[model samples]
Target: MQDKTTLYSLRKTIGILGLALPILLLVTHQDLLSSMSHYYYTAGGVFFILILSAFGLILLNYRGYPKQEGESFSDRLITTVAGICILVTVLIPTKSENPLGTLFFTDYPYLFGHESNGFLGAIHLLSAASFFFLLGYMSFYKFVLNHDASASKNRLFRRSGIIVWASVGALIIIFAIEKILKINMDEVFPAYTFWLEWVAVYAFAVAWLVKGKIHKDFEKMIKTFQTEKSLKKH
Candidate 1:
């Protein structure tokens, strides 16, 4: 029971961090960037790195529910891959030409703008894509491994998985269109990547929160409060 509680707590924390990250970035620095990764060039860079680092570390350490009979993959192995990929995204910042705020690593040769190193940017992009794909797989398949097809939570996991993949698809299409047309879509709808990324993260967060049994905890707290109140009245 204690082990289960600890795991639930960890899930809840991950969900809360995911849900709060974008809001925190926007609040800390009102000026939005072209993508969430662009926030690395902003004052919110610290928060961006810190939160993602936390995510990577936690996932690397996470030992998900014990594998049921005949399972092919362990949750820990998949999460470890996701963790490493997310860290790669962090270590290799996205390609950007402009600095959004007081830049960190003053002496570190910067990767910025059109003239930035293509190889590093490619690495970051690939790592990020891999991370999201793994997340989608976990939500769509791994999370439902032990559940009945009609389970409510399984349904939620499937929906979240779809949303994650859909967001990834939209992002890929946008990037392809921009590259082929030599267009800057950010001018038309500023920070489009940030919004789409938020949708994917939000879906992941919601599914995790449900898996953590947050609703049950909330109801239990309410019931305890009501019981105490009734006792006091009598």
Candidate 2:
């Protein structure tokens, strides 16, 4: 059997990738996220990040099934819906790029703006929203609700859940203000809501990391597991 440390290391890497992916999106520096739409579907890094995030969520789902009463069906359904949202979120391009522009190689028809994207962008937005909201809901309500863990671990889960839900609230407020005032999100915020998005994604990443104990110093645990494995070999 693989040691605890190695398993945690893998989980930690996935969590960090989930957290860092949006920050990578921040570096694109394009004039319009609404226009460019996550640096275009052709951007390999962005695309990879989505796939990684979706897979990570799937991993989390597998880890989430608890032997608790009355939690199984709802948890499974929610996780399934969230995973589907993530998948669709990845498959649906945020917006297309102009054939005459830098992203022409993507070969998708050019969509100059949100209006240009039209129905497709709407679906993308819905999927993205569902993904975030569902993850936050799962964190705040379901995760650790049944897992009998120590006080400190439960506290960690609670704090992570709070952060995840807080991000969702912040996004709602930001969008509400933008729409109510009829101003662009970029004009109101430094990174044009990217940081808002980042917090949500980071929260999603972090809650799973806590659940998986990915950040724990697993030396003692690993040693114990190794000792038990060697005894079994006899």
Candidate 3:
């Protein structure tokens, strides 16, 4: 019952965020319409819709893994790193110009005009990319790679990897197309590639929220590996 409650909470949280992201962007950045003069409002509108849809999907599918014993320390460390990356990417500025600055720097360019500077900008970009990669890898591992084992009792972990991998693949393909076509991603795709890029982000966030269960699962896998190793030594 406790596990169910936690899972429900996790799903609710993610769903709310997913639903809110688009709304927040729309409400706060409505000026983007005029700022990015070259693009049609349809682009931004569609992107916002996509963001809400992605979150809705997350809310609908929030069943996390159960706890296991004997997890690896490295798993926890990597998860932490990935979480930080995701946070930074979401909170920090992607370009030289800070969004907050616009409040005071009223004269700033209306769109795509801000230039991020120095290490801060670099860190932001690096963190953003790393966040995506870490998210993809972790989700692939949990939902796809480790979904099933001969000895594991939990069935919820099964088939999850496929979902994560599919989402990752979709993101990669979308990114590639955006780059290849030089679609003026900002104007063409609408608000960060239709918010598809954020799925991995939210997935990772869910992973963190359920870290205890995830850690246990990792530990169990590690113990299983060790047991197999010991048996081989006999």
Candidate 4:
């Protein structure tokens, strides 16, 4: 019962936090965020901090794995590293020109418009990339392990693994296309990467939620999809 409860909580945390990053902007007022003219958006800073805090809590209160015998030392370490990466990503903040928010940066003045310094910008980019990358890796490799015999479980793993990989692949393809076309990613489409980021975040959320058993009657859903795919293939 305790294990079940922990799994449920972890699933909720991962699902909400993952989905919140993208939706935060839509639900927020423009005046409550930054107004960066580049890859960063008006509300990005506060959103980043919110995600950071949520993920921090996740790592702190995570009870997904059993504590007995400390057999999941590596899992714990990976989660810790992932959590740290999330912190770095959030704390560094993106390169913004006009951060309008107060709550996220009241304590960290240096966070706003810090990308002018190349080193800090690099860290922010690296941390953001790594944060999602690790989540994707965890979705594909870690969550799928030791799943039960339920056909729904197997199908859920397959879907989540495919989504994570597909999202990563799509990002790469989009970047390559943008480079080939000489598109100024920030200027051509302000916060274009934001859309891609949301794609990944949504995929991560869905995958983790499924792992958390968010879907009802997913085995039937899987069968329907499989059947449709087979028909299309033929």
Model 3 local distance difference test score: 0.45
Off by over 4 Å in 1: 66-72, 98-115, 148-150
Model 2 misplaced stretches (Cα beyond 4 Å): 1-14, 26-37, 41-53, 56-63, 70-73, 96-115, 216-234
Q: What is the C-alpha RMSD of each candidate to the true structure, in Å?
A: 3.2, 6.7, 14.8, 9.5
Residue 15 lDDT, candidate 2, scale 0-100: 64
Candidate 1 C-alpha lDDT tens digits along 26-128: 8877877767887776678778899898889988888896666787767888888999999999989887743333344434554442226689888888888
Residue pairs clashing in model 2 are none
Clashing pairs in 4: 34-42
User: lDDT for each of the candidates?
Assistant: 0.81, 0.60, 0.45, 0.62
User: Sorted by lDDT, highest first, which candidate order results?
Assistant: 1, 4, 2, 3
| Per-residue C-alpha lDDT of model 2 across residues 43-95, encoded as one tens digit per residue | 54354446555554654454444346665446557766877776676667565
**Could you tell me the lDDT of residue 225 within candidate 3?**
100
Give the 10-residue window scoring lowest on summed lDDT in candidate 4.
32-41
Instruction: Report the Cα lDDT for residue 29, model 3.
Output: 48
**Candidate 4 backbone clash number:** 1
CA displacement after TM-score superposition, residue 186 of candidate 4 (Å): 4.6
Q: Candidate 4 at residue 121, lDDT?
A: 67
Give the number of the best model, judged by lDDT. Answer: 1
Order the candidate numbers by TM-score, best to worst.
Answer: 1, 2, 4, 3
